[model samples]
Target: MTLNLENEQNHELPSDCEETARQVIRQVLASENCPYEAEVNLTFVDNDEIHRLNREFRQIDRATDVLSFPMTDWESPANYSCLEDDETAAGSFNPETGELLLGDIVISVERANEQAKEYGHSLKREISFLIAHSMLHLLGYDHMVPEEAAVMEQKQEAILQALGITRDPEVRS
Candidate 1:
């Protein structure tokens, strides 16, 4: 698995924050048991750029925290059609290096920072949740229906909890 993180805009994100993000991503890749080599892009942007993307792609004309574009063969629930299965096992042969590109995830720092405040958590927790959520989306996991969403939510929570990142009240023992 390859992680390509690019910060084009002027944002002074801490090094620790970026490392933590990468660590979470690595764990996800390993846990997924993805056989073929994969490449993913992580981009950080501002509210304006993310809003434009939301309007253009989703046509919602609003801002969002994260956006994922998966380039693979995927056929699952109809409502989550926004995802394309990048499953290397599904005969999605990457012609070039026989490696699949698992699409991109763009995050709005502005939104994450704001949400952390609203959620009464650190920016680190918010970023971890966002990364985990988008990674699940990349793997074609969705909450389009109640059942599917519950499954995905449980996985998300499990991953976060394993990483010691949670939504629970602080456990001061």
Candidate 2:
């Protein structure tokens, strides 16, 4: 697995954020039993940048915590194709690693920090959850429907738990 992380925001993010995100991505991929070597590009942006993206890509004029742009057609959790090798395709596989370029994950650092305080958890935990959630999205998970949301939530919680990231007690009860 190769993770390409970029901080496009001016926020003072944790120095270890990139490593944390990589670990979360690995855990999510392993839980899904993904067979192919994978590569992901993650970008950290501020609310304004993410808001612009949400408007342009989703036609929603609001900032979102995270957005995922997947590069594959997912047939199932276990079966999916990296973008076609044709140059006409949107993205290509990495020649050096032979890893499928999974796609990009954009996160709003401003929103994440606010959420961490609102939810009474560490910033690290919140960012880890966001990365896991975005990875699932890249791997064909959607939570638009109740059933799908339930499953996605379960998978996210499981991944976080496996990483020893749990809700702060004050936030829980």
lDDT of each: 0.73, 0.85
Tens digit per residue, CA lDDT, model 2, 4-63: 888899977766787788889999989988877899999999999999999999999999
CA RMSD of each candidate after superposition: 4.9, 3.2
Residues 11-42 of candidate 1 have per-residue lDDT tens digits of 55655777777777866766666655777789
Residue ranges of candidate 1 with Cα displaced over 4 Å? 76-98, 167-173
Q: Model 2: clashing residue pairs?
A: none
lDDT of 1: 0.73
In candidate 1, how many Å is residue 100 off?
2.7
- The worst-scoring run of ten residues by lDDT in candidate 2 lies at 81-90
* Candidate 1 backbone collisions, by pair: 72-85, 72-86, 73-85, 74-85
